[model samples]
Target: MKVGVVLPVFNQEPQYIFECIQSLQNQTFRQFKLAIVIDGANAETVNAVYEASQVLTIPFQIINRTENQGIAYTLNEGFSYLTDCPYLTWVSSDNRHYPEFLQALVKTMDSTPKEIVLVYSLYHRINEEGINVSNSEEMHQFMTSLMRRPKEQIYSVCFLGASFLFRRQAFEKAGGYRNKFPIAQDHDFWMRILQHGDIYFLEKYLMEYRVNGKYSLTTLTPSEDLILESMRSSIDNRKTIQDIPKVSVLLTSYNQCKYIDHAIESVLNQTFTNFHLIAVDDGSTDGTQEIIYQKKDSRLIGLFLNHRGKAHALNAGLEFCLGEYVLELDGDDWLDPQTLDIMVREMDKQPPNVGLTYANRKLWNQVGEKLIEGPIIPGLNYGDKYDVLSNLQTHCPRLYRKSALKSIGGWKRFIDGQPAILDDFLMFLDLAEKYDFHWINGALYHQRRHEKNITLIQQEEISSEIQKIVHAKIKEWGNEYIPEFIFNEGSLVKVDLRPRGLS
Candidate 1:
């Protein structure tokens, strides 16, 4: 039941060292052991550590090494001696834990289901002078946002902050800290260990992470190459496939050569591999078809058709879909690796009548050559026929039952004889009429907005088309389908509707 803590020290300031050790000494829960690993310390640092170790009343050990190995090596060396402790965690020299840090983490780990092998808590970001830099409320909101992501996404997002505890078994299974990604060792380790078991997030702030500019490893930025290599390795290692796909993704594009490859790769690299990608190119004269043919994944099926609009291209892709659920992805957009896994799992939990499930989306503006992140468009929890018709951009990463989609005659050119610019919206309206819609909370879809985007190029035309469709649908469904408007003063404020006849 004892917790093992490793404090890895390089050339940190003596005052910080004393304060860190004092934090441990004053812990509310005392059934813990500390290992102070001094990695090639200078004479002053070694003496300072010796002086700081005097105040510790608990059982502790100091491991001194002559060579200046990095954090990963030092961590491995320190944990090697704490084999008797069931729970293990490591702390940085510049950080200080709250008195209840060890107590709360141990309690949570003890109470958590056996499937969860690790637990992490929120932490306060402090300046060099120990002044809190981040607002408490803001930090809580930020951490809560990260907590919404499923563990399947750990490879892409690292929500495990400074304060964390893991079972020794998980540590052993992960093979300890890796030396490969020296700067991103913790993130790499988290990705590897997550494969073995789930991680629990404790919402309390339990530690003060000191941002001591040059003295802290947190300030060091890992090279983008290193990050990409680490992510690629982690993703490749975690790839799992099912013999039968549960979902089929239809990625349709037209002259999107610049972004098509990334979109295809995003679908192929998804953590949930039980889906096939049907990438349809609608006569791209800009080499988009060439990139689609170049990809060699067995799960990918490439189709090059004559110049047709998106609706036609989607219907073409639909002809090859072999999954129970279908998702349509724009070629200029990509997805989070965990999108399929999370959406499929969520959809499976709903009733058969819930034919559609979608998640939030991240907006990106692709100017000339740069891509800039915009605000996240949160998905509506429940969308009725009214919401679908009113909101132009409803939800994304929309995973729908293939049977339901087929029953409604798939995608259609709802506008003139030509393809409809609001094809997705039209599809949504058709699906909304026959089935219910559910929403998941994470920003799983990456929507890129550029000059070449259809929605942007034909905004006025799309608006006019949407209005015509809405009026026609309202007329067809009669008074029950027409929305009742609530007016404030002289302006209209809200529209209320009770749609209850389709079931």
Candidate 2:
């Protein structure tokens, strides 16, 4: 079966385009059809592709689009156009393949089972000066960690350079490409198609990825910065975290532009590095999103939305989470360096019945710039679900087990602008109903109280709803678990929210 190669061409230098076509012609395996699709580039760029197709001895076609569609659409169009070919793949005009590239890939696809949807190989990059750089740490490190991990785990950012053969069946089943991701269109395809079947990895280097092009990932424009950030955010949030992160920290913010940088830095400073920070912006008007973008940490996934309520943003962030345990933090709050390791250790010690765990927090005021107090604990004990629900915990500092959180269906908000207050309280109550909780002994987070704090204003507005939810849940449970009943009897909550000496 002849392999169909789709080459998406844009405004690249003519010499570079010719080199891409020349490499394919020199391939050890000759049974391939080369189709070049030109997407509304300049006259010179268009002529380069046309000229390359003329020089080729192999069967080829040139598709010229009058208007610029994009890399994703050009790819999908090429895939659909090549109906007779069973194996499909694409290469950027800026990339060139080794003579043995097609041969190795075809041989592997021939011997492997049909279930193998993709065949990718290691690739080296060529710097602008025509020097061959060694394999990137990203690809090597990625493959090394990937082989040892369980298949159930998911990952993103797996590229075998610019050319990898894909079975038309698998590509078709994955719905081809959505064309939504712009620069990251290929990444989107990789993520979706992975859901269908396994991908085979080859150790041999197959393609040379040229890095000097203006539109290459190496060269980023200011707006493409956001696109690249979103791509990284998407990849980092994918199920397979580096070294299998045990905890996911959901750090949410609205417009704390000044404080968010520190908040992110504190998480990065944590002693426990095996965690992913899913940072969500609740449509910040200021530079809150921009500040988040300033961070270069791979662990931080920055997502931007348009003025969704905090509850909606929180729930939205949960969609990208892939952690076993989840920690909730605010944009104004910062965590102590040892908080993660400590909480993880505490949770590790607890039985599966324990759904949540929290530690004491140091209270600080943004205006005053002074420590308000140290070791402030919730005035609740969590020996049982009843007591924990009765004293609904706020966002002082807590980590939750994902499975138990999943069972309760995550955070709920009044989507139709009912102004869903007390979401954290409801989340606390929901988890408390099914599993117990425990408190660690030290202060690991700093909760900065500010005048614009959402929690401060939401308390009075949501008090009735909090009571109503607690009352309804207790009623639906139809058992001895009663908040009023426990309060009337005056039993201390198993979770002590008092300050250290006070407790």
Candidate 3:
């Protein structure tokens, strides 16, 4: 089982290039070849590649070009040269592969079905000197379980940056990478090949992805909107509903005229375009109804109601849903752009027992300008029945299975004198008996905190509602509920209400 590895370097340091070559040379599985392509690298890098090829014992193929054609063209040249190898993958110049990287990928591909085009393993991000700079250690178990189901739709970049061994046939079938996506060429290629065949995730650490600390901690394409639009085009032209929507996004607003536009735009610009959006105006006297009618998008289903409370408005939106999953967003708050897509994909990978998955979120100051703090679930595993009963965790930004939600009788109708948004908590309590919940690590929602917010009621009233809800659920579900934060604890939770910060 021989494989081809393409190393595309551009303006990278010679030492980093050597580190890459040495890492490949040290692989446990030896049946592989390195196709080194230098795209506008400095003199030192070109010299180093040439020098390393002479000393390396593995099969070496170097394509050093004189002019600086972008990474897309350089990678294509390397891909064209790999016609002799059956398996394919590429790595950045600054990253290094583990000894078992090739072995793990080959071993998995050999055991799996032939239709699996690529098998990408978990990778860590390292800085210039190759020091680990992230919490990748914690995600090992969490992500391993998440990737078992391969039918999910991907919104943003989730695969190992450049750490997969792909089938050569699939590459040709997908027409290779597109040059128009300067930085997102690989992601574009991934999207294309995913349509051709399934992708397998190997749960081993295969490589280290280098990050440009000078620019950003991550390597997402700067032109993400362009990539999203290109992906949308592919969906738009699909012959069948296989790639069509399986999720519905609901945003209910009463008088959020000032903030409603941004909320609507966020949903409209999602990378995963399959889901339908229903924005209910809840009979706002303000210009919120006008704003809802302004979008004129086919995916958007705007409905106007007569000053109904949030519970009534949300149920109205749910009535028109055609998708299997539902994403709940607030009228005053906006999503992280990728929230709907990522959550829907994550939910797709879940088992029958797992009915919902929520992600971490960012809390913003009044007017939603400054990012005051970033918040994550207390732990990755805090979604069980007992965990939910505990007053420690608050759940929001939830993506739910439409069937499960409907089976549970949809949103709990809010009665007067109830804590604001307590209906959501009641809905979750009932769902907890029959379904499971999972948490994703990334913070993708922006929660606005201000005087006019719905959940900003008095602390004593909130505490009373939460205490009543938790104890009632405990009795109903036969689970012990004990909270960590006791009397005099700060950071604002319901005095009696069951709510989390910024949810």
The top-ranked prediction according to TM-score is 2
The stretch of ten residues in a row with the least summed lDDT in candidate 1 is 235-244
lDDT by residue for model 1 over 1-503, one digit each (tens)?
Answer: 39889999888788888888999999999998989999997877788889998999999999988789988999999998899999999998778899999999999999999899999988888898889898677666856776655676664445577889999998898899877777778878887788789988888889999985467765565433344444444434445323346888989999998999899999999999988787878878999987876565556666677776788888877866778899889999999999999999999998988888999999999988999999998987545676766554557988989988888999877565655777777888888888998889899999999887766676557556665676677776674665554544544334455564754
The runs of at least 3 residues in candidate 2 whose Cα sits more than 4 Å from the true structure, single-residue gaps closed, are 1-61, 64-183, 186-233, 236-243, 368-375, 415-417, 479-503
lDDT of each: 0.80, 0.74, 0.71
> Candidate 3, residue 300: CA error in Å?
13
Could you give candidate 3's per-residue lDDT for residues 1-503 as a string of tens digits? 27888888776667777888888888899888888898877787789888766767888778878899887788788988878888888887778899999999988988889889888877776886779775565566544544444433332223335578889999998888767655556656776777678888776678887886432214433432433343343333232335346877888998988889988898889888887787877878889976776454556666677765888888877876667888888887788878877888788899978877887767776745644654543324644566565543555688888888888888877434552457777776677888988888788777777778656755666556666666666556544333343556544342233343423
Ranking by lDDT: 1, 2, 3
What are the TM-scores, per candidate, against the unseen true structure?
0.52, 0.57, 0.51
The deviation in Å at residue 280 for candidate 1 is 22
- Model 1 clash pairs are none
Give lDDT for model 1.
0.80
Off by over 4 Å in 1: 222-226, 229-233, 239-503
